[model samples]
Target: MIIKRKVNKEVYMYSIGIDIGTTNCKLCVFELLSLKLIDSYSFATPKINSKYGYDFDIEALYSQLEQGLIQTINSLSYAEKVKNIVIASVGESGVLINQEGEVVGPCITWYDTRTQKNLADINQKFSDEELYSITGIPIHSNYSLTKILWIRENCNINLQQVKWLCIAEYIAYKLTNQKRAECSLASRTLAYDLKNHCWSEKIQSAFAINHLFADFTQSGKNIEVLTSTISTKLNCNQPIFVAIGGHDHMCGSIAAELKPGEILNSTGTTEGLLLLLEKVNFNKSFLTSQLSFGKYVKDDLYTLYASLPSAGYSIEWFKRTFSVTDENFDLLIESLLNKLDDINYIKNSLNIFIPHLRGSGPPKRNIDSKGLWYGLGENSTLADILLSIFQGLCFELKNTLITIEQLTVTHHPIIKVIGAAAKNPLWLQLKADILGREILSCNIKEAVCKGGVMLAGYENHYLDKNAHIQFDNPIARYIPNPKMTEYYHQIFADYYQPFFEFKTSLEFKLKKDN
Candidate 1:
């Protein structure tokens, strides 16, 4: 993406990017012209264990955000000026606040299954077909609407009296006193009317959630300028403009310049494959595929998105749980690829690993499913298991991409990968071999934050859109190894495919009997 360069704009005019992730929250300051990183700070997201699952400590979250902002701004030279600040975050979690902007209830996370009962109640009222048709989200508790309903009922809060703001929106409100929902994030809520591009009247009225959210706006829409209190709090002399940055993946897609027949594989704690399209597809084929459809960062465009909730989290969980060291698991399996021609050896050595650690996504979206590994021998080493985890995540991604191809009826040759996936060469190669698609490692460090910066730059006439979309070069490329790709095709069809079906059934029976 092109950097902002105009004068009236000095060398020190900068933009701030606030990315509130599930695991790590970051604040980055970038030079609007060079797009050089000036300063950055990071902290863990504050989450507390609730009776049902986990709830975000809002006060703690804001405190950490405030600290990062102050540290980034104060470190600048006196000549520097701040232009715009934008926020991006997870789409599924938010906080409820009273009229005075004080948090009123617990902010439960999207993965918390405590809202299953609330979802079932809604399912009883509307058919799954109708629900998905209206919201473009499958019937799942991971969306904001289910969690909002859970808080409203469990906390005994009056839905009509208070309002909801997603985590990013909350941060913006604290700075600028504007309570606006980004269109992309608002599209994730099950209560949003996708066709009409507004809040759903039928669903909101049925659930008594009228007047629960403020007005929705496009990403990078200039809502308001920073308040005096915030300016003084951060010790900043110049004014700061706050704009909505929308969902993390949609924001990252801006840097990728994602176009038709191209897919963006955003890997972080979670992983999602996002395909940009001129129109939305909610047909029955997509309904069964269970891929989510939502408003893109550009208000007129749309996205077909599929997620693996435990992509990177699975690696972290295995390393932490098993106390595995930072050994090179990738090298341990390189010798195995050489034996692809030996059918007998390949069959005996290959093990099945399924990463459903944070529920299952697409085709059969279920929150009850857990991860599994099969064919583990008594002598299985930690390194061997780690290799399996990496291979498992690649296979899981392939499974979703197959459904995406069948539904969209489009085949993409080169898939652009950003975020954590770009940093890991082994993961990218494995994904290329498994999917038989070339993987381009678009390694712009903190690309999502860069997206926020770019949006703010363009909104303020500091950037050129045509020039910014020219970041079409990949830092690295991973082409599929033909021998390895051929071997994977057989295993994916003969073993992985059949095992996935069996495990889905097993999970269903386990949930039903319980």
Candidate 2:
């Protein structure tokens, strides 16, 4: 698919990026000249139910994408200029199986936890350390591999003739009729060996699951061209270009221009912090994989990531649990700030919250871990609870930072904050204090989408010789408060020690019970 690059004064070439998220799907079009987002649209993901315990609705997915693209195009000032489309989707290991290669089971959501038993058994068979060393991710029921194992054990479906594809690959198949998975998404699967950049024969043999993996593509490589049908649907005379951008996290980091000592924190439904590194730092204790997706950057770069299963979800939970209306919730949070203007409520508050309402993520991927409220008494009020939740999230971020720091002897790298949560001044300030470092918040809220746009722009020759995206928004930096930092260090140490000890004991108990 070739597009004629016509240089115009007022008319700039645009690239489109579609992010298929867990709850919603987003579409954004960017002007290649300035790398500025020109237009954007989003739609809620359609839910599905299946006969085999799992539920996924591909028809709804198709409908949403169609509607989102149409709406986005209609809203654009120059829709005809959109020359490329890139997709970054959530990762999963389950295969869509049928005689005709149709998606049979629902897209196994990364949040789904029905495979607890499968995960425990996998851990017992292959020690947690070894599994992490191979997969780069800890053994968790949420992963697609365990979900597949669960379905095979319980369902009556044949594993033969099935094709395993990640969420991104599945979408690409639907759009372009191709069955290709990218290295970024493939690496997330427990079966993929990070070091070799392919499915691990050793891990596959250990699991004894049928081989149904898809071919892998490196990030930033163009995989397939859009079908004529999709081009007609979008009302574009030009061909739709599809490229292999990796996991949303990796792509977002690339969009943010992540470098060594520079971290990218994406705050959405799940908040994650990724640190770019030059070389792999293997940890035998944790058994982490040394594999990473190749960077789009000219120089070699790797990433160390820490994800929290619940970040914005925790706030959502709080709102629903307390029955706080959206308007009232904002007002209440604003009121808390006004009431505690003189106090460092997040750092100095006596209360501590463990935000594991769903489950703990990373370092301790404990599914059984429940949310807890510590140091709470009669004096604890709604304001205190609110502040505690923020502190809890900050503490989690601090824990991940400390782990990355220990793994790599780096210190005080400027952390780049992005996503919806980055808009929260109090939250960003709390994170700065907890980490004892400066936080740089990018002007762009949709960094992942912009990252895709950056890739598409580079592919289309929209970027300058230096490969930089020209934007008007200046980077905002927040410095840590030394007083609050000192207090947070003490609170973090006391609160985290007990949590780790409790987590260790709980893990032992779960193993013994199993």
Top candidate by lDDT: 1
The TM-score of candidate 2 is 0.89
Runs with alpha carbons beyond 4 Å of true place in candidate 2: 1-11, 48-56, 74-77, 93-99, 120-125, 205-211, 288-300, 338-341, 344-349, 377-379, 503-507
Q: Clashing pairs in model 1?
A: none
TM-score each candidate.
0.94, 0.89
Deviating ranges (above 4 Å) for candidate 1? 1-9, 78-80, 325-349, 468-474
Lowest lDDT sum, 10 consecutive residues, model 1, at 1-10
- lDDT digits (tens) for residues 1-514 of candidate 1: 1255443445557888888888888888877677777778889988999677998787899998987888778887642488888899888889999988789988887677888888788987898889888988788888888888888778899888888998889889998888888888988888888888899999888888889988987687767888999888888777778998899988888777777668999999999999988887778778877889998887388889998899889977977897655664445445544543455654555788889988988878898888878879987766556657777888899999989988888898999999888888768887898899999999876788888888777776777777754342357999988887888888889878898999999988988898
Q: After superposition, how far is residue 470 of candidate 1 from its true place, in Å?
A: 7.7
